[model samples]
Target: MTPTTEHRPQMSVEEFEELERHAPETVRLEFINGKVQVKAVTDGNHDQIVAWLQRLCMQHRPELWLYAERGMKVEAYRRGRARPDGVLAPFGFAKGHGDWSEAEGVLMTVEVTSHDADTHQRDRVEKPGGYAAAGIPVYLLVDREDRTVTVFSDPEDGRYRLQVNKPFGAVIDLPDPVNITLDTEPLEDLAT
Candidate 1:
């Protein structure tokens, strides 16, 4: 379903803060291009990818803290609120605090693609730029149907210059912020 531009004014950091005070449980909102966009519920494939990534991160690197489907307010020259499918933060930053504001240093953020063309495009194209602008060093994308994981790194000029695409079973070296090596076998197994 296409989102309507109606209801409330264009999204701003201040406006989003106000809305957060009154946001309902059923409705999830994200700020995109100064607009509040509703996030759709994740499908099974999305859930699988998230789970696989989280599990792999935890098993390989127990020291790093990994968050799933949590709201992260990334402040760049332009402000935006994003909920990455998964985020890896350095250990001993801030534990037991669900608030992202307290957990400042983030190593990597991941997004799992859905069947929707718009969603896939946004995650693969727009979000990389946004995350890079926010100074997020690493961004991983898991494409379920394609059975591939794309790793984007070395953000420069609001974009990631390095793109590494690996099909199932390839080992991906997690970026500098976190020290860990993960294999894509588990993610590939999710397809079946």
Candidate 2:
């Protein structure tokens, strides 16, 4: 038998898009698992880090496209959508707007850990499982709490089979989609 849609949203994707369209620019919200969650405000440091990563990714691969804080649908047991700091996909992926992109052909997703405890947990813990379940090849996590960048790759059975981490001052080597060594020396600790 063909596989069926295991997850269904409590609020339809159309409703989520409508809510986002009317919501204020400062307010960040996400339809996670079945409920709408008010996300934490993005700090200056977080913005800076995301900017730098996006720029670097663009420079490294001009053929591909990088989206900043783009929504993507990735879940196996619930209709959970996650908006990552940066999502690396093909050139034509932006054509599909105002809705969550299916997590296929997605190169990798970046998540810069924020200050809020809840947001931090969502990014560091919950999102990985969801992304992996959706067959996302790579999940890059920038943890400001410990000043480390962790790369989770090789998803199998809703979990990453490999994990590698580097401190803020070291060079982080990204495989596949972005086969380049990133200079993490420019990244500053948010605790300051």
Candidate 3:
């Protein structure tokens, strides 16, 4: 379920940013659904998956770059802040940006499920709402736990109108704005 902003936030956005800035390098922080969330550090396999996607993006869409751990202001009115595993945007998109960039011009936000208690809520639920609310075109979720790839697109009314899921070996086409087709066969060995 997409988290609702009905409840009061744990802290203001500025306060969250201050706490995040002082947080240790090992800890990644995100503010979503009016609450602060601790993001899990990427494991080796997770890093490999991101790198694999990075290579593919570079090859197929040379003008675009899959930026690793790029932070963005998500949710409606850009209230929530999230650091997606991979953020697909135009090359040099981060040139003049600070830690958190506006969601404008972002083609897609990618999240690879981590082995953590909140992975389901953070990656599958909250993120989709936040990204879609921000008008991001696509959200790609690589689920190591389920061994599947799910694509969320057609953002409308604070949610993705369409969702498509495929097993690791299947071919998945990331929809428009991020028009890259993926042969997820290479991801089979990297799921673990």
| Most TM-score-accurate candidate | 3
Q: Give candidate 2 misplaced runs (Cα > 4 Å).
A: 1-18, 189-191
Error of 1 at 109 (Å): 0.5
In the range 123-189, model 3's lDDT, one tens digit per residue, is 9999999999999999999999999999999999999999999999999999998898999998899
Specify the highest-lDDT model's number: 3
Those runs of model 1 whose alpha carbons end farther than 4 Å from true positions after fitting are 1-9, 92-103
lDDT of 2 by residue, 74-187 (tens): 767536777888888877886756557888778898888888868665887778888888888889898888888889888899888888899888888887756857878887
Per-candidate RMSD, Å: 4.9, 4.8, 3.1
lDDT of 3 at 95: 90
- Candidate 3's displacement at residue 94, Å, is 0.8
Worst 10 residues of 1 by lDDT: 94-103
Candidate 1 C-alpha RMSD relative to the actual structure: 4.9
Q: For model 1, how does the per-residue alpha-carbon lDDT over 1-192 read when each residue is reduced to its tens digit?
A: 977776434866877867865889776666755666666667786787787777777887887766886677663664777777888876655466554442258788888876665676567766788788778888988877688888888878878888989887899776677666778887766764
Ranking by TM-score: 3, 2, 1
**lDDT for predicted candidate 3 compared with the true structure:** 0.95
Q: By TM-score, how accurate is candidate 1?
A: 0.80
